[model samples]
Structures are given as C-alpha cells and as structure tokens.
Target chain A: MSTETKQKKMITDVFVEGARKGWNLGVNNIIPNVLMAFVIIHVLNITGLLALLGKLFAPIMAVFGLPGEAATVLMGSWLSMGGGVGVAVSLFNEGLLNGTHLAILAPAIYLMGSQIQYAGRLLGTADVNSRHYGILFAISILNALIAMLIMRIFV
Target chain B: MQEERKVGLVSYLALIFAIIFFSGLFAKAAGWLGVFDFTVLNGSFGKILGEGGKAFEFRGSGGSGAKDGFLFALTLVPTVMFALGVVNVVEYLGALEAARQLLTPLLRPILGIPGSAGLALIAALQSTDAGAGMTKLLYENGEIDDNERSVFAAFQFSAGGTITNFFSSGAALFTLANADGSLAVTTPMLIPLAVMFIMKVFGANVMRFYLKATSKR
Candidate 1:
C-alpha cells in the first residue's frame, strides 16, 4: 500500500480503538446510575416514600414552580443529567406541561450531578481527604436552590 | 514515573476522540430508540416516602426490554467510567505533572488551587457526575490542600457538566429551530448563556465562602 494510504488506515485504526475504550468507560459509569434509578423507582413504588417525600417538599418545590412530584427528577438530575432529563420528560408528559414551563423549570433540572465530588474522587486516588467531596455537595445543592429561586421570579 | 506506565501523547488524543464519538453516538442512539420510554418500567420504588407520600412519583418508561434497557444503560454508563479510567491512566502516566508544572505559578496565585486540582476541574466541566468520582479520587490523594479542594469543588460545582448542554440542550435547540424552519441563532445563543449564568452565580459563592472558611480554619 502507498505510504499515504497506510497512514490513513493507521489513523482510522487508532480512532476506532480509542472509541472502543471510551465506550467501555461510559458504560461503566452508566450502569450504576441505571441500576440505582431502577432500585430507587422500585423502592419508591413499594414504600410510597417518594410520595411522602414529595408532599414534604411540595411547598419548597412550588417556590421554583415545580410540582411536589418534581423532587425525584431533581434528585435524579443531581447524580446524573440523563436521569434528571428522563424524569423531566416524564413529568412533562404526565402533566401535559407546556414548553415554557419546562423551559423555566429546566435550570434546576440541569443543575445537580455534583461534579465537584467526581473531581475529588479522581484526585483522591493520589491521597485521602480531597476535602472537595463534602464541599461539592454543598455547592451543588446550594446552586440548585439559588438558581431555582431566581428562575422562578421570571416564570 | 515507571517507564512501563508511561502513556504517549497519542494515547491521550486517541482517548479524547473516542470519548466524543461514543458519547455522541450512543446517547443519540438511545434517545432515538426510546430506550428510556418510561411506559414499560414504573416508579423508582414501589411505594412513597417522606411527607405527602402519595404526591411524589418517580416516572419510568420502557421496560427491561433487553435491547432498550441495555442500550440506554450502556449509553449512560460508559460516559462516566471511560472518562474516569482515561483520567486515571493519564495521571498514572504522569502526564499531569508536566502540564501542572507549566501552570503552577499561575494556578497557585490566581485560582489558589494546586496544579493537580485543575485536571479534575476541567474533567468535571466536561461531565459532572464523572467529575465527582474523579474529585473523590483527588480528595483521597492528599495532593490537594483543604483550601485548594474547597476552591476546586466550587469551580466544578459552578461550571461542570457542560456535556449535558452540548447534547441535550443542543438537540433541543436544533429541534426548536427546525420547528420554526428558520436559520435563527436565538435558541442556540440563549441556552448556553442561561447555563453559564447559572454556573457563574453558584461558582462565585462557592469559592468565596470556601476561601473565607479556610482562612478561619
């Protein structure tokens, strides 16, 4: 084969290999999230815990123009964006909610997932007490609350 | 660093490309197939908890159909694990040391975060939850001081998880634009800005309070 053709083939091979590895990691991260979501859903269903929690948080959720039901989605969003979006889409369909409402409500949905915690874990492999773990929880939770408040004003 | 552990630049670049491709392909494919349709599966738990137990509900669709459930799970899982593994491998290869050395002076003074902390921050910005896992690793490393960790946390909390913006928001933006059948740039611009605005407000406070607390400690 010509040098140019060989080089092209090599590049393609490298790209494919990288993609394979990337997919492997993506699948690993997703498993827990999917499994957790399944477990959480099942637990909520059997125990009626989600409903009780929703009622408890309903007043606070109303502040952000979300129903008491939205707490689950918001919580899901905190751990993984997909879970949150999944919940959001479900809520919209269930309530027949309009786009504008979903738009205004989407900010909080986007928040959470607590990235700082993830950072801590990566860095933690080097040593213990990255300290960012707890801080991330605080930052993510507070951010969601504050963002929700401001977004609500416009809604 | 051990020679056996060293990863070349090509390895890093290859990993990045692969990640972008798989994430884009799988996430979109899963969405398209309606793997997360929610009709087949039910609530997270069988019952409710907390106040107003009956009021809260977790929604699920799409059953444990081998194809859809497996596909959806695969799409989401790999994003986090691959990013984490790549990051670990890269760091293990001491790639960050060279980069960190170059940025120490600037990062130390301005961001007040250790050079090692920057990698996690950048990674988290790409994907939030995965970043959290990364951050936890960093925390366990003792490479980051308390002050730096707090600052790092704040930065990530504020700005991380843009992956969602790129795919979810990007898709929505396109759909909205298509519905209008216009070449307008309004939706494209607004969504990013809104996401950014939310990040900034929280990011600033997270850093501010963290700095203050560290000073007191």
Candidate 2:
C-alpha cells in the first residue's frame, strides 16, 4: 500500500492487524513449541535423564556460568527459539536454573537459534552453496557462545 | 519495485518510539514515562490464592506435563498480542523504511554487501522468508555476487526473523520473575538485542573470511 493510503488507515486497525498476526504466531508456533519443550523436559525429569545430561554437560556449561542442564536450552533453541525459551523457563521453574542463567542464555538462544529450520528456510532459499553451510552453522554457534560470555558479565 | 521509498521524519520518530517501547528502559519509571515501556504496558496477570494461602498467577506452581504447558502458553498469549500490536503500529509509520534508509549506507562497510541489500537485510530481521526471497532476487539479478550472498546469508541465518521471533517468543523470558517477584533479567532488553546484532555482523565477517580463504585455494 502507498504511504498515503497507509496514513489514511486507522491506527487501531493497524494495531489489530499486528495483534492478529501475533495471535496466529502464538497459536501456531509459540504454543506448540513450548508445549513440546515442556513435555520433553517432563519426560527427561521423570526418567532421570535430565540429571544425567546435567552431569555430562556441567563442566562445559560452566564456562558460560550456566548449569549443565542449561545445555538443554541451547539444544532446544537450536531446533526452535520458542522451544529453547520454554526449556529455560522449565528449568527455572524447577529451581535448576536461576535468573542469572536465564539472562545469560537469553541472547545466546537466538544467536544460534533455529539453525535446523533456517538451513532450509534461509540458506536454501538464498541459494547459498551447500558447501558453505558448515561454516555458516559454525559461525552462528560461535556467535552464541560469545554472546553468552558477554551476557554473563552483565547479569 | 526496488525503488527507495522516501523516509520522512515521522518514520524516524516511529523507529525511535519502537526502540524505547521495547527497550525496557522505562520499565520501572514512575508516572507517564512508564507507558513507553513494553513490559510496563504489557502488565502482569492478577494473582490468585493457591495452596498454603500463597498467591500465584493462573498457571500456579508445581504443575506438570502437557496440562501445565498449555496454561503456561495461555498466559503468554496477551503479551504476544500486545507486543505485535505495538510493532504493527511502528511498522505502519514506516519505522522499517527509516531503518532501511539509515542502514543502507553502512551495509558496504559492515556486511560487505551493496546498499541494495539493505532492504533485504531489514526484511530478514522481520521475516526470514521475505528476506531470503529478496536476497535470492538480489543474487539472480546480479546485484550481488556469490561470495557476498554467502556473507549475507550468514547474517540472516544466525538470527533469522530476529525482531518478530524475539518479541513473540523471546519476550517470555523478559517476563520471568524471581520467587520474590522481582524481574528475572535486570539487564535492559536493548542490551541483548544489541549483542545479537553485533554478533550477526561478526558471524557474517567470519563467513566472508572463510569464503575468501577457501576461494584462494
């Protein structure tokens, strides 16, 4: 639409339009992703696998000042950003992760988030050579690691 | 269709408003200034009495499994709606166009891509699909070469759909509180956002270096 017609559009209508988009995103993406994360965490908890994973990743996560279980957040976020947040929140609620951990993980989540989906959505669509895909993934993971280190200082 | 749209002063102001609105800068400010804050305006759910006479939001405490997840997701709906509503207003006023204008010049020095990629860069931040499509057009139309495309893809791939994804799902993290009800993250929202933007640039540079080194062989 032209600027003139857009200016003629009601502000309220514009807001409603955006809100409707948010509604769809929430229902279609956030809700499902979060629900799946929660269920995954629940299973991990009941099966004692969460503890084992934490023990395994504790030393590595410590470099970023996060708990070992925090690795799950990064793993989940790698699939979907919403899922990562859900996992982080679930850990926080379980008293496994504190506020500081969430703060540190926040930016890192999206920095490397959604690589699996974006491999197709972004790289494939942009027609970037598949040969360069490994480097692209590495760069994003490096970015997330650096972000966590930076955020740890602030929080 | 790729002609540059005129960015007016209103667009710049809209962009500024969008920044402060989501920046969490005035979240604790008293009086009218607080209204400029996203978290302040998003507000909190009312409390209800739970076990031990303690107050809890509708999601309550010690819940488990899909049922709890459903309720937790439900609580996030209004926040998502409000965030998107404000974002829509900002976009309608041309905040993005203003951003494109401001960013176009910096694209060369920063990402090593042409100014023409500015629109695609901005679009990518909002929607991955739009950005990717535009970027493909840029390459196919000979606006950018293969190496530049790789660098640009690195930027988009790292934090694709940044603004939309952040405000929609990532906003939930900003809402988390300690047991005593203090905000979970005292760091301003803008800080993380800035870090992501910087890292995106850094990642793109990494790709640029990689492509250059490999091509030399």
Candidate 3:
C-alpha cells in the first residue's frame, strides 16, 4: 500500500478505537442497572409491592376510567411497554379489565411509557445523561397525563 | 469550500416520507389479495379516506384491538433487547472508539463535543436515560466538561431516539398513508412527527447557540 493510504487507514483505526472505548464506558455503567431493574421488577411482583403500589395509584387512575388495579400496568409501562402489557395481560386474565380498558390504557402507555431508568439507557446510546433526560421525562409525563385526561373526556 | 456529503436534514425528512409511501403501497398491494385487513379503531381506510374524518365510537372487535396492541408491544421488545446485545458486542470490539476518533475532531469544531462523548451521543439516539447515565460516567471521570455535556444533552433531546420514533410515529405515518390505498400522504399522525422533528432541530440549535455564547464569556 502507498504511504498516504496507509496513513489514512491508521487514522480511521484510531477513531474506531476511540468510539469503542466510549461505547464500553456507556455499557459498563448501564449493564449492572439493567440487571438490577429486572430483578427489582420480578421481586416487586412476588413480594406484592406491585399490589401495594396499585392501591396507591388507584384513585388517580379512575380519572381516566382505568380500574384501581390498573396502576400495576401503569407501573409496568413505566418499565417498558412489554412490562406494562404484562400487567395488562394479568389484569385481563383475572377478569378485572376488559379489552376497552386496555385500549384506553394504550395511548398513555405509549406516551410516558419507559420509566427514567430505561429511558436513560436509550438516551445513553447518544451520550446523554440524567439531568437533561429528566427534563424530557417531565415533559413526557405531563403529555401523558393531559392526554389521558382528554381521552377520559372524549372517549 | 467543498460541500459535505453527510445526509441533509431534508434527506432525513424525505426518508420518513418515503418509508410511509412505500409501506402504504405495499399494504394496498396486499389488500388486492383479500388477505390482510387494516383496521384501526372506529374507522378503516375506506371511511377515513372517503370522509376525511376520525371515528367517534368504537367500531372494531375488542379482542382484535388488544391482540394488535399486544403484538405491537411484542415487536418493540425484541428490537430493544437486540439493541442491548449489539451495543455490548460493538463495545467489546471497540467500534465506538473508531467512531469517536473519526467524529470527535469534527464534532469538537462543529458541535463542540469532546471525542470521548461520541458513544454516549450515539446511545442517546436509542434511549435518553441510559445515555445520561453514560454521560455521567464521562463527567465523573473528567473526560467531558459540563458545557460539553449540556450541549450533548440538548442535541440528544432534539434528534436522538430514532428507534422509538420509527415504530411509534413512523408506524402511524405508514398506517395513515396506507389507509387510502395510494398514499393520500396526509394525516393527523403527521402533525406529531413533524412537531418532534422540528423540536429536535430547533432544540439542538438553541442549545448550541447558548453554549457557544457562554464559552466566549
């Protein structure tokens, strides 16, 4: 290879190395938390922390026509859409929620869905952090709340 | 000065439009087979396109609604999980380091971000909270300064997380376009997508302007 081409290749190699390090720093920081979040979620279910929170979020959920127990889904949605759907599935299977209720919960679930921790992982892909992420989270929550309130009024 | 080859913002916008347009055409071609039904709540492409309105009452079967919702949620899980593994593997191979080496010098001059921050910026496009956690690590380690972090944060909020937008807003765009069988190309879903895009651009520029101004002072 010509000297110029070799030089260019070296430059490319260096940048790739740097980007890899940056990615490592990000992954190392988040992996532990990701595992922990999963464990916490499962533990919450087995320990009835899920049920406890359900009662707590009940009255507020009623404003949007969701059942008192629907709070579990809301919390699940906060974790991930699938997590939230897990809650919805359980609620449906238990005969506590109908398809319509799941439908009502859909938009809000989409809106403020991924809680801060998971959202952090997503934002991390682009190298963003907590304080800035908090602002977006706050905005998303407000959007979801208002949307649910409107859905209650219209639907 | 030579023109840069990086895709322009207009190209990104066009990509969004093109995806919706093609998805609609594909759906219509499928409809001709009488094999796939496209039913949204309260209305279908026929009523929605012909009348130019939204349905006020529930019209579809409830079971299908839940089924569809579950299916949509299901699709998202694998995408996220796969991203997690891919990110790890990429890190293991030092791909981000190459990206940082190539882009940081450019971004430092143009975007004013340090080379060390490149990976976090890319991750932010996937998820904000996780990106923040990564950025925090860089800051704590003194790899990036506060000003760089602030600017990076703003830029991320603006246009990152394309994955979510692809499924959520992008799916909506395709749904509306396909409703009419020939890509009517207009729908309520367009409003949110446009708003988010605008917010991302304007938000990033606003952040950059502030950081630059402060740096001079």
Q: DockQ of all candidates, in order?
A: 0.17, 0.80, 0.07
What local lDDT score does residue A108 receive in model 2, on the 0 to 100 scale? 88
List model 2 lDDT by residue over A1-155, tens digit each.
56576678999999999899889988998788778878999999999999999999999999999889999999989988888988987888788998788889988899899899999988998899888999899999999999999998888
Interface RMSD per candidate (angstroms): 7.9, 1.1, 11.4
Residue-level lDDT of model 3, residues A8-33, one tens digit each, is 54534543554454344234422332
Of the candidates numbered 2 and 3, which has the greater TM-score value?
2
**Candidate 1 local lDDT, A40-148, one digit each (tens):** 5556646887678778978977877777767887777766665665544434433323344455445655556534344444334323244555665666666667766
Lowest summed lDDT window (length 10), candidate 1 chain B: B36-45
Candidate 1: tens digits of C-alpha lDDT, residues B92-194: 3344444434445566666666666555554554565566666666666777665655565565555355544433332232222111223212222234335
TM-score of chain B of each: 0.42, 0.95, 0.47
Ranking by lDDT: 2, 1, 3
Stretches of model 3 off by over 4 angstroms after superposition: A1-56, A119-137, A150-155, B1-217
Candidate 2: where is the Cα deviation over 4 Å?
B1-3
| Total colliding residue pairs, candidate 2 | 0
Candidate 1 docking class: incorrect
Model 1 alpha-carbon miss at residue B19, Å: 19
Q: What is the lDDT of residue B80 in candidate 1?
A: 35
Candidate achieving the largest DockQ: 2
lDDT (CA) per prediction: 0.48, 0.88, 0.47
- Arrange candidates by TM-score, highest first: which order? 2, 1, 3
